[model samples]
Target chain A: MSLDAATKPHEQLAEYLATDMEAVNRMIRARMASEHAPRIPEVTAHLVEAGGKRLRPMLTLAAARLCGYDGPYHVHLASTVEFIHTATLLHDDVVDESDQRRGRPTANLLWDNTSSVLVGDYLFARSFQLMVETGSLRVLDILANAAATIAEGEVLQLTAARNLETTEEIYLKVVRGKTAALFSAATEVGGVIAGADEAVVKALFDYGDALGISFQIVDDLLDYAGTEATGKDIGDDFREGKLTLPVIRAVAAADPSEREFWTRTFGKGRIAEGDLETALALFAKYDTLEATRRDAVLWADRAKAALDAVPEHDLRQMLADLADYVVARLR
Target chain B: MSLDAATKPHEQLAEYLATDMEAVNRMIRARMASEHAPRIPEVTAHLVEAGGKRLRPMLTLAAARLCGYDGPYHVHLASTVEFIHTATLLHDDVVDESDQRRGRPTANLLWDNTSSVLVGDYLFARSFQLMVETGSLRVLDILANAAATIAEGEVLQLTAARNLETTEEIYLKVVRGKTAALFSAATEVGGVIAGADEAVVKALFDYGDALGISFQIVDDLLDYAGTEATGKDIGDDFREGKLTLPVIRAVAAADPSEREFWTRTFGKGRIAEGDLETALALFAKYDTLEATRRDAVLWADRAKAALDAVPEHDLRQMLADLADYVVARLR
Candidate 1:
């Protein structure tokens, strides 16, 4: 890990983009409201007010500034990205039957699944409105496709859950759809709005995509390693019977007995007491955790490599550092 | 009524727009598919292939044709509108926890709630993508707002479901959001896409808005009238404790004894045998069912009146007849 990343590059980027962040937040508050349906705003406020790192929208602001955009629409684009992210989170909570998010009761838990689903739909519709206001068909195209890809990725993950046949290729596709698609679109739209050259836009997209891939891989690895600040329960992926990267790798390398263990736990949903510890031990013995960490670092390196085409600037440097920081927790 | 109007105007409209309806159907099939998530196509096909009338998309097609649109993009607009409607129905079934739709098992029943929610989201995203391909920001804006309104109306309905105090004004608002908003937007976008005159566009919007309101009111009334062809079960709203127009009217005029009955059935949810029949008796005493039917006729009249400014085309005549046919069953 880089020495400077120890100081938290994400917070640094947030600080640097505070003004634009405020604008995005204002736009979010303004657009999430429905004059007739007070429940829409109430449910949305419950989630949007919960403090998660506004990383995706920050990526958009930073990318736009780095691309020399001085226009007013980047804020709209950033808010649009955040709205899409928030909508997905609302639906995810309902799908996961989750009760807590960002250390607070989830919208689905505070309200019912009906409110969560309907409000999520409202936010998605609002997000499309915000993006359309940008008046860039190219921007709309990129964001719309990203929205579809995110849903596709989630559905794929749904079918892949607890299925031992899920491959690394399929995992990558899911990751690209669920996480990186929005990340890449956030950055790509930023550059596209700035009228940046195609190469620069492509570079920003690749950097965001690789960085997002790295971020998700690190998150998956941390779920097994017991990180307190991961905002996720340790071994959650295990308990949920999700066949994430480390577990998938461990299953691939398992002997017949170990394969039977995985089948009982994930495939058959027979998770018992101490089974998580046993699974952790298998992850250790197979070095699958380390393998997953190595994959994260590789993706982080690719993220940095993608930035080589962009003009060397402080924002670009911060973006590169942000990629490093995503994996820095492993250190 | 016109002599030919004794037949279903919806079928006549479908026959008139058969070629365009085929195009819309092709787009629906093509766009509902996902290469990675086969489950999406599976669920969507169950609904799309069902023999329900393609009414909303037909509105878009008929409006565009009546406005002298000869372009190919109206088909895209029509397809987009249908996708939005289908997506909402999928989510609505999950929200309502219904076991059947269009005389078949609901998607939620056959697949699950999670698939229905996520697949509904996919269709919404797909609808946005389809609209954006037309390269019309006006269309995007209209459709996006309509989508938001649909969600808003649904949330409003959720909060107002069992409350006896739900006024006629609020019921109308819910109806506007849930039904009329999309209908108006579908027709509005068709005219906007064809570069129709402002008066013609406004006329089309008003026509669709009134027609949708009329359509929903009829559906609500038919639930009490014992119509087998309503495709909705008799007393289903009463069973679910939904306060539709008839109930709202009865509640408004309820004497103390009638109010107590409503409180027992709807407010407290302590429905017993013969409760629905008793509710029907109250509806008859207050004349709320007949009053609701009158409201439907009023809206239908307004719908036909709004078409006065539209060009005198065969499709326009069919649309006017369609409004009449919406209330024809009440006779």
Candidate 2:
């Protein structure tokens, strides 16, 4: 079953991106190592080494390279992205009280929430240090703003956990804050630190932002229909009572009986067994997943189109493919 | 009471310090204002306006000025220190499950643990932003390292809670990480940003470290013995099952009856109503409070001596008095 060497996913990437992604992994491993605290390394390794596709840092590294960055600090930027992402995951698990992530016991489950929290704080400190090493005040500003936005998004999500009144505008804001903010910032800073022109930086930012919106939309849909390769179980968003895009659409299409079911499943205390199936059927009946997929493709196309306004290069081609890859699972 | 016509305490030396502390306040108020997210200003202002003694930031302010550095960036350093201190306090209240802090409702109590944790993170980000504006890599390094140490110390305290086997070394390590690290770093960076010699930086660090240690010792002692001005609700530490230095020493000095009391009060959750009185009497019987006070004075003296190695100035004399003030209530 071994793939032909030419057909391998890593081999299939355009030459420079393959190299950049590899470089990002190397930097993450090297920087996350610490001599001061064993618990830090121990807790962080669970998320960092969990093989979660390295999508966010790749956005950063690729943007930096594409923008003609020759400096060595892009590696640091990539590592900072991963660190921030990991810190959020650590805190997210605690907030969600979820015992499993990536089919592995969460850090909160393995080591108490206290350790997860402290380790998350430690990673944040380390991220700040890595960014400081870059010696770009602009990078610090972008990253700091993104950090605040990410937390706000998280708190917004926390508050919006059970409410069914989540409009598309609020959802987009949450997505922008929680997911798109960092994704866009990662690329924005990439173009920023490379001394790119303002136009190029803005394009990279818009491109990243669109890609992130599409990526998150697809994720919300797939939580009701994704397979094991995606590392998410079907109906995760539903079971967690998250009123994501699919549920939003489905709830709009819900009839009176369906509304009762929704209330019982998400709002009321009685979560009977087979609720996921009923929810999925409702989603299919409303064609919400399909609608969601179309939205993802629309945004993905917008993401690629945003890049068309930027100066073209091999990295631009890779970025186009990367945007496609973000929604690849949706189709 | 018209004593202002004459010399106030530390007036000869601390008059400038008094002026500088005012400057730190102005900076804190200014930096904490944000126009983007109103919640940020609200959450940050809660702790910033809580009327703390402002000891940590004052250390930064005093250290920089004492070293003959008149740079305005010390205001940034002071604000950074205060932000870090505020962030830690927010997280500590959550970790300690505290309802009241300084006779006021804790952030966790007023809001929730989620808000407290998230807002603490926001403040941390804001603090980094402030430090980055300083444009001193050395300052960043010092503050980042101190932040890590502070988080580690808090983690140590979390894991050490309810454990009776906490040794003196562990206690000191915890205290240094939680309190002394920031104090030392605040002073160390003050000397650093001032372009002081390494010798002065190290001396200031020692001064701050000893002062912080003395401050904590006095705090623990005050929990066992002090009047309202010093904010002692006697034996509160015992009621919390926190094994302070005096309590640890008293446990070591306990007989069979006292051993039973220790096991029941601390090891088990059977602390009776009068257990605090009994614990205070045990501290008195073993003279552990007096011994702890003596230890505090020793550190205070060491803190005063740390300045002697540096060149003498009015601000230097004020730092000596500040150290005295930290331990004065005990006398």
Candidate 2 ranges beyond 4 A from true positions: A1-37, A67-72, A98-105, A160-166, A191-200, A227-243, A247-288, A306-316, B1-42, B67-71, B98-105, B162-165, B194-199, B226-243, B247-286, B309-314
Task: Give per-residue CA lDDT, model 2, range B1-331, as digits (tens).
Answer: 1123365333443355667777777877776664434555677788888776677877887788878888788888888899889888877766566322344477767766666777778778778888878878778888888887887776666656566777777778777888899999988989998899888888999999998888888887888788888766876666666767987888888899898899888766577888888888888899998898888889989988889877677677668877777777686
- Which parts of model 1 are misplaced by more than 4 Å? A1-7, A98-104, A229-231, B2-7, B98-104
Evaluated against the true structure, the overall lDDT of model 2 is 0.78
| Number of the top lDDT candidate | 1
TM-score of chain A of each: 0.95, 0.90
Give the 10-residue window scoring lowest on summed lDDT in candidate 2 chain A: A1-10
Model 1 per-residue lDDT tens digits across residues A1-331:
3555445788888988999999999999999988888888898888788888899999999999999999999999999999999999989977787311233476777787788889999999998888888899999999999999999999999999889999999999999999999999999998999998999999999999999999999888888885667556787788778788998999999999999999999998788999999998998898999889999999999999999988777888889888988888787
Which pairs of residues clash in candidate 2, taking residues 3 or more apart in a chain or in different chains? none
Backbone clash total, candidate 1: 0
At residue A238, give the lDDT of candidate 1. 81
Q: Lowest-scoring 10 consecutive residues by lDDT in candidate 1 chain B?
A: B96-105
Q: Which pairs in model 1 have colliding backbones?
A: none
